[model samples]
Target chain A: MTDIAGSATRVADIQAAYLAQARSKRVMNLILIVIFAALLIAGFRTADRRNAGGFWDGLPNILDFPADVIGEAIERAHLLPGYLIKYLPSLIETINIAGASTLLGAMAGLVMSLLVTRGLGPVPWLVGPLRRVLDILRAVPEIVIALVLIFMLGGGPVPAMIAIALHTTGALGKLFSEVNENASLRPVEGLASVGATWTQRMLLGVVPQVAPNYLSYALLRFEINIRASAILGFVGAGGIGYDLRNTMSWGAGKFDEAAAIFLLLFLSIVAVDQMSSILRHRLTHGAKPGEIHR
Target chain B: MSAQALHQQTRRNFNRKRLMSFALPGLVLGYFAYIFMAFDMAGLGVRVNLENARTLVSDAYSYKTHVTQDNRTGAVEIAIEGERKGAYAPGTAPGWVRLGETSEIDLGGGHVVTFGGRVTYDVPGYGLVMAEPGAGGVNASLPDGALPDFISLSKNRLMVKTDAGRLTVTRNRAEVFKYSLGWELFFFTLDSPYHGMSPGALFKAAVNGEAGAIWQGFVGNKMWRHGDVGWALLETVLMAFLGTCGAAIIALPLGFLAARNFTPLGGLRFAARRMFDFLRGVDGLIWTIVLSRAFGPGPLTGSLAILLTDTGSFGKMFSEALENVDARQVEGITATGARPLQRYRFGVIVQITPVLLSQVLYYLESNTRSATIIGAITGGGIGLLLTQAINTQKDWEEVSYYIVLIILMVMLMDSVSGWLRRKLIKGNGGGH
Candidate 1:
């Protein structure tokens, strides 16, 4: 009985030693993790201080100016009634900018895409340079381009359309090229073998395969363009961004109305998102391997 | 037999037509270039540089351009192409140009006679160039030493390189950059005695301008007394660097958690995964507005904006990385009766560090541009300086310098990230 007890104690000692070593290893890992976390925390603190002015400077105004400036306006304009009347109309106008820009941009994109693919067929040394030009157009954002147009057009929707269209062309051209590359090579090659023209091949063999995806992408871009249009208004390009900026600047602290606008925009975006998925799924049904029979 | 020959001839004609098919691309590019230059001139700062040679007049010059024209001749007022380009063109008139106190005569047919501090002619539109001020000489014969930063003497035509791309300058008319810069890194931008302008042309107008025959172009600027360009530069770099670091901190854990394959199916993990997509769905600038509102406006806003946006972006990416890992290792751990967490820690996490590091580095590099835009909006960093430059729209030479610095910074960041990506992720396509 004593021998049996001694053996049990020895086994217990070995188990405890192994457990302690394991615990120490975990503790070391935890220490390293803490150090990393501390470093990140420090970074955030520094970043916050650097940006403190952005949040704090408007505070005294956010609180006091809302009462001083906006309170009078609210009383003077008859408050709730005036805002309620103008809000939906203003929102619609903002929506209009997105609609117009997206339409114009999509059309331009379609044409530019054809040009990018050399659907008309490779022409000259200058054609190679066209790719370069497209690169430049794609590199700068649309709003930046719009700023220039605004100067030329004098604060209107024309510049906004131009900017959106130029960007859409670039983006679509890229997508188009990718589509062209992925199109049914056999059909296109078969057309080519018969000495069919570049235009013929593109029209018959290429466009069909990717048209659905292209449409879906264009719709997606339109949704994005809507939001972008709203923002560009801040720079005086024309849209709700202008209104948002003015209201905020004038201390129109009716965050409820603002919140409503945001909510509407969010819903629009979500609807667009769901639509895109549905459309894309329909277009590429069973695109995943083994999902459907060829 | 003649009929057969005729049929062969027709087939040959069709092939030739195929080659000619690309001619439209040239027309398209030509039209695009024209529109770009025109918009830049109308006080929209959009420009495009082609390898520091000639301004493609796209992204290097004008900084930005927006115009709506239908086919045929798209009439847009271009700022033209030079630091002093639109100095002759007036400022801030709706339809008319200022045309400054300078005069340019378009000799109609690819020749422009320019008069300011110097008299010179640029060849009509690139492919060949010459500026003749001295008696009886082509651009090549213009007294030995007047060439821009990158002039190609090898070609029969004189090509002046600007924006890191050479162009046969002034084959048409003298245009200008409506911006200005002081003697800030002037020598670096130039390749020593570049710009075929005699010292008289470059320096004669400056307050302490001095002119010599061959290198007389040494002029000191007095108009742009330094206000706030230097500190702004440091802030710009810091904004980009800190923005990237902050983003990485947010991205790493979320990336792991959001990874589709690694995370166990539960409400908590599922919510985290969905959060990644939702965050990434919105644009970076949009986030800037929200965070700037919440965190206050500054580089911090820009940085946080980037952090939030990139967390979503990287989470989606890391999830894919986790999915792509070799499953054999996980199987080995599981066979030993390791817990799911242990299997993940030893099997997946250890393998994907390199991928995470490399992707984070790339995102950091990309965020530099985002940082600039955010800074521009939030009123912080060099973008504030850039915004101020745009607001004034008169000192394009300075804008040019700022643009050059920004581009250089971008290049530096790209190279650094590429190096880091390569170092971390060996024998693989480093985080596309």
Candidate 2:
């Protein structure tokens, strides 16, 4: 009894409370476990003969002859350091695709965001359907949009740009609206008190507050678009992916070269990401009270 | 016009900054319209329809078959294994042969077969086979041999022609030869049965072709595929989750450290205030890829990546929540001379647990959605599935199905997370 009493009362009480919570959550936990199990079973059950002629074949291909892959990679690795320098052309292209797409997407997102912002639009006519459109727009995968755009633009940088922009608008628009919604009502209210119209208050007061956030989000979208742009070439959009398609098609087993490109891309993204975080921190935490960006 | 009327005009211009409200939406719509026109939706629909028609034809197998042996126009063929002789109609269901590499057909009874995607794709239809010439290329360019007498009649008048002495195939495996984005788009599309001509296959073909040793040459670097695309997707998710958890863990301790009402030591509280500034200053992706390369791949790199990224994010969120907490309970802890950790345990942590949970759930939802993309680049998980899909262009309908599954998984996670947050933070389900 003394030993039990010696235990910290805070720890014991907290444990007791946690246990109470867990006991109540048992039903839910069990239900989730069962649901997850069922899903897993269904997925596995459905997984039939794989790699009839796709990535699955790579396994058999690998096991059957490791030398082919290894030999090519080793040989390619010799020339890869020099080939790595060649990534610049694609990198520049990627920047262009991302920049153009982000510019286009931000414009669309800005409009849709404003229309859907409950605080700004308030009226259902503007808010309701726009929100649904944004939802549907986001619902479809970006690749599908890319596929559809390929039809129109005929598979160059243009289709990929348009596809990225469309999806980005929906995603960024949602974020923008949240920024608008959380916007301090003080400035807007003060503007209204001075008899400024709804539109006027949003501009002089609302726009200024949320601009930094919008910019940050737009920059983030650009980073994403850059990645998307690089991949678009798999479908013939443009960039280094076209080269990848060819290399894989050749099956010369130049995995080392492919691996190098991958390594570089990952590193570059990391750099971009660091910059974004710093920018976000500055925007959010730098300013004082009302000076803070929405 | 009076002087007052002129003054009113200037005031109107001042307030007219609101004009962006009306002009802006219209302007945005105008730009959207311009983009839509630029995409040329009508042309793309036609191309897709053409491609779909070709696929539908191949899949449907609603064609008549005819074979000419040397000069025998009408088909009169006999099998030798059991010496079974039979007269077959020119156009009839032969039975099914497994049409795709992934899709296997029984063809037990006839040529009609059933198939499915890892699940079941058994459909009733005849898969025509070239009887005499053997199952070879559609176009018979067999070297040093006379054309054997066999023909396959498949969907859309599937017919094999013989040139001089070789069998010829005209069916389009891919339109990549077209020299347009259409060809690339066709190749880009995943979800097809044919494997050889797809981007991945083409690469393999080039590798195996005379260009085998080109991989070792300066020219070899041109083969650098978008392999990293796979890992990027994995890296994104791993970092997002771990970073978030790290942030929560750090914030919990620091939050207590900063809770002035709970901690009589103002010095410790001041230090806590600076934790968020330090933590939240870096992006999650940066943290992950750097770690991945440093640690040399796998979830460890991803975990560290997430830890670095999320610490900042969660620290910010948590500190904000700490500021809004009620002071009364915290003050009560201070009045008792309890250690700093004890007061925080009693005062801040308990109070903000619900808020922390809700935010975590929200972040998890976001991270899960983004996780696929990171995995794509990092060479791990389902992003691999997606990357393979784009690279191979095997069959997109199946890809669509997978996409739907992922979305449902995300939605399920979101709902469950929300429910847990609600239940835990504001508990009230018990009679005890």
Error of 2 at B6 (Å): 11
**What would the per-residue lDDT of candidate 2 be over residues B201-296, giving only the tens digit for each residue?**
656656776344322322222111223322333343444455455556666666656655445798877776555544433234334333433344
Top model by TM-score, which number? 1
- lDDT minimum window of 10 residues, candidate 1 chain B: B65-74
Candidate 2 runs further than 4 Å off: A1-99, A110-133, A139-160, A176-294, B1-247, B250-304, B316-329, B351-355, B428-432
TM-score, every prediction = 0.56, 0.48
Quantify how close model 1 is to the true structure by its C-alpha RMSD in Å. Answer: 16.4
Which numbered prediction scores highest in DockQ against the true structure? 1
Off by over 4 Å in 1: A1-85, A88-121, A124-128, A193-195, A216-220, A285-294, B1-245, B255-266, B270-287, B293-296, B313-329, B336-342, B350-366, B396-432
> Candidate 2 iRMS, in Å?
10.9
Q: Model 1, A200: alpha-carbon shift in Å?
A: 2.8
Worst 10 residues of 2 chain A by lDDT: A46-55
